[model samples]
Target chain A: MKGNFYLQGFLTFLKIGLFTIGGGYAMIPLIEREVVERRQWLSKEEFLDLMSLSQMLPGVFAVNFSIYIGHRLRGFRGSLALAAGIVVPSFVIILLIAMFFQAFAGNQVVEAIFKGIRPAVVALIAVPCIQLGRVAHITLATAFFPILVAVIIAIAGVSPVYVIIAVAVGAYCYGRFFKEG
Target chain B: MLFLELFCVFFKIGLFGFGGGYAMLSMIQAEVVTSNHWLTSSQFADIVAISQSTPGPIGINSATYSGYISVVNEGYPAIVGILGSLIATVAVVLPSFLLVLLVLKILNHYREHPLTKTIFAALRPTVVGLLLAAVIVLMTKDNFGSVTDTPWQFCVSVFLFLAAFVGTFFYKVHPIRMIILCGLAGFLLYS
Candidate 1:
């Protein structure tokens, strides 16, 4: 039974890592399907909590969530296994691409394929932006926060670290003064 | 020594790499391109483009590729370059591992605290904003192409972008399917 937990954790993440494209957010629904519905490793509410907390951390959401879930299921070893399973496919794929990148760098066919995919990537990213906005519940009163942060980072080229820090502090103060009152 | 440096550098990246991979781009640019000079701007752009199209998390993929290129560029052997990739990938995820553990520990106790709720409340909207910024940044000439420089390519890209955006937002087309459709579109039109 103990060994089964580790193997299950490893395989689950391996499948998630292998199949998911378009990065971490893209893995959300599949992850839900596997972790919440199939394995029942985490309940739906628990999974949602993990998702929210995963975003607040620094690294990739996929990895962060993997660690959180793995740790919850087994322990340190389980977390390690899950992380390894999740990262291996990506690490191997990118490494190979980097090694022989010169061969395909200017290849017309590859360039054409990438050119087509680039805009698709943009659209892929935009889907999540809209989804996240809905999840964040951006009302008129609170809409300025997102707009201000976007302008400061994207337009002004300010460091995102400072913006996140400022927003966090501002929110804390807002909560203390308004919500608590 | 190079491996240690690679580890430390990526560890820092992981600790502060908010908003996922895209938000982490500026920080990575600062560290690898400007501060360390490990990769040039064009190389950075190439890595971003490639990583975006490839599998896995963009942050992890970039770290793996960047670490390898950084080490190999330093007169290291190919074998050493592989080691560099492994080191960077592990070190990049380590901080998050520790952090998530710590958060679980602390938040377990503060599960019901209003202050905790307040912190997340602010973070939620900010994350959304950061994601929006990532979209806008990618829409630039570098990722999409400039209109004046190459009118045809630019027009196709814009059309694809609008088509994809609408397809995703209104039609709810799966992203992978969109990728396939766009790949075919690019191949037929450009190739």
Candidate 2:
């Protein structure tokens, strides 16, 4: 049974690594579906908790989530297996593509494909923003803060690091200075 | 000296990088542009544009390009250039792998910690901020020319943005499908 569970963990992460596009938050729902809803490996609460941890950690959220989930299902070995499985496909694909990227670097077809992907990427990131915002129970003020940040970064040409710093500081100040606690 | 520096720097990036490619951007910029002076700010920005549009993680793309340029323009040896980029990429990823293994070993002990839960909650909004930053950078790139000169590209970008927003929020389209559709649209429109 343990062996079976380890395999399941490995395969689950493998599938996520293979299919997930746009990375990070875009992969969240699919992950929730597999680990929480379908496999019953974790409860909704546990899954949400894992998500929070994954975010706090420094790496890609998807990869971190895979690690956390895999660890939950099996032991250290399972975690290793799952993390490896998840990354292998993308690592291999990217490596191979990198080798030949220059060949098609200027190809119009390639350019067009990316052009299309760009907007889709925007949509992909945006949808998650809204969904996750809802899940986080963000108030209108909180919601508007991120959108404002987005626009400033997007249209006003602000640096992202500054935005992150500003938000963190803003949130901290609000919590410290304004909160009635 | 330069070659060794590149190698060590990238190796560190590869080793410590936790949140994957996007997360590595700030660090990479800090090291390469701010600290090392290997690349200028504009050059770093240009590399970012290329990395995003290309196939691979931004880390690898940046490493490869930086490696190539470091050698070609600065007379650094090819091996040093390659080694530098490779090292950073590897360094960034190593921590996550090792940490995951360690966490797995100790998983049962901290499964229900409130501190862990609180940290995760705090991180959710931050991730959103990071993603927002990425979108903002891409949209406002000077190459796109103020939405005036490149009206068509601007329009396309806006349309796709709306499409993706609707698909993910209202229609519930999977991201993979969205990626495919966008790829196809690129071929149809740009080709």
Candidate 3:
């Protein structure tokens, strides 16, 4: 099978990993843009599906994400490539920063830029939540559920793992016993 | 012995690191600083600051830095520190790789089962909520500026936030360009 696309995908993960800051949620938009728009590696719904699965798993959200995308498109080796691509940038960047130590410590210019970025990153993250919400079919009737979820998590400070477990179990039991859609 | 300890610590971190990068911060702090005394709490804070300002996941970034710095802190050479970094990064990522493959195997096996489908479908909205929660969690005074205390910064932040939200959400402005623009705006205004 032609695996050239996986190579490009690996490079894409590398770029995304290098450029995208703030981690976790920040990577979501860039990955969505690349995989869904530029690369067409995954459909919108498929991306959301993979994202939800990634969250449920116990690891760094971005790592789990790359692994899923890699496995889906290019099997195990693909997963490895993508995972390394996402990680190597951070590893190198951190090591370099550590070596210099005093030079870049509390660098004002970098801090200012990130101060500007922190809010934009929020926007960057919020926009996709909305778009993916649509993809997830969160409509009027079911809107309350997601709102409750947001409240439980954001306000009450509940961990997302519990939310995932409860929802999955509820849906599974309901679907199995009641034959509901 | 140090390398072995680093490997074991990071592997455990990876295994239990749920929800996302920020969620793992406390666990990492406990292991590296509180438990192992590999680094000081302030040093760990510096790692966090560096990690936040740089690219990649926080957990992986912390692991890499902790591995190298912990070794160097022990008076090892920088070359040895590099090995420490490599070992920590790999160990942290290893569990995730193995776990993801396991889940994929099961999901692929039950690819056609309705119950699995139901569970998968039910998760979609929850993911939405979780993403929203991420934004909310991040929308602290630290990121957005406190509206009451830091009025000017707060107003400018609100503008930037709206501008970014509108620019991307409505006009289809690419996020990379948006990021650069915001960075420039921030430098010019704040600096």
RMSD of each: 3.8, 6.6, 7.3
Cα lDDT tens digits for candidate 3, B1-191: 99999999888878766546754664565567656889864466446656767889888898999998899889998889989999999998898888866666786567568887787677777767776766666576767778789888788888998998999999998766777788778787787
Tens-digit lDDT string for candidate 3 (A1-181): 3667667777899999999887778899999998899978789999998887787666788998999998888888889888888998888999888888734546777666656766776777678778877888888898888788878876775556567778889988988898853
Could you give the TM-score of chain B for each candidate, in order? 0.73, 0.55, 0.58
- Which has the greatest DockQ? 1
Q: Model 2: residues >4 Å from true position, as ranges?
A: A1-56, A65-82, A144-181, B1-89, B98-119, B141-146
| Runs in model 1 lying further than 4 Å from the true structure | A1-8, A25-56, A139-142, A177-181, B1-9, B17-55, B69-80
* Candidate 3 clashing pairs, residues 3+ apart or interchain: none
Q: How high is the lDDT of residue B128 in model 3?
A: 75
Per-residue lDDT of B18 in model 3: 53
- Winner on DockQ (1 vs 2): 1
Comparing 1 and 2 on TM-score, the stronger one: 1
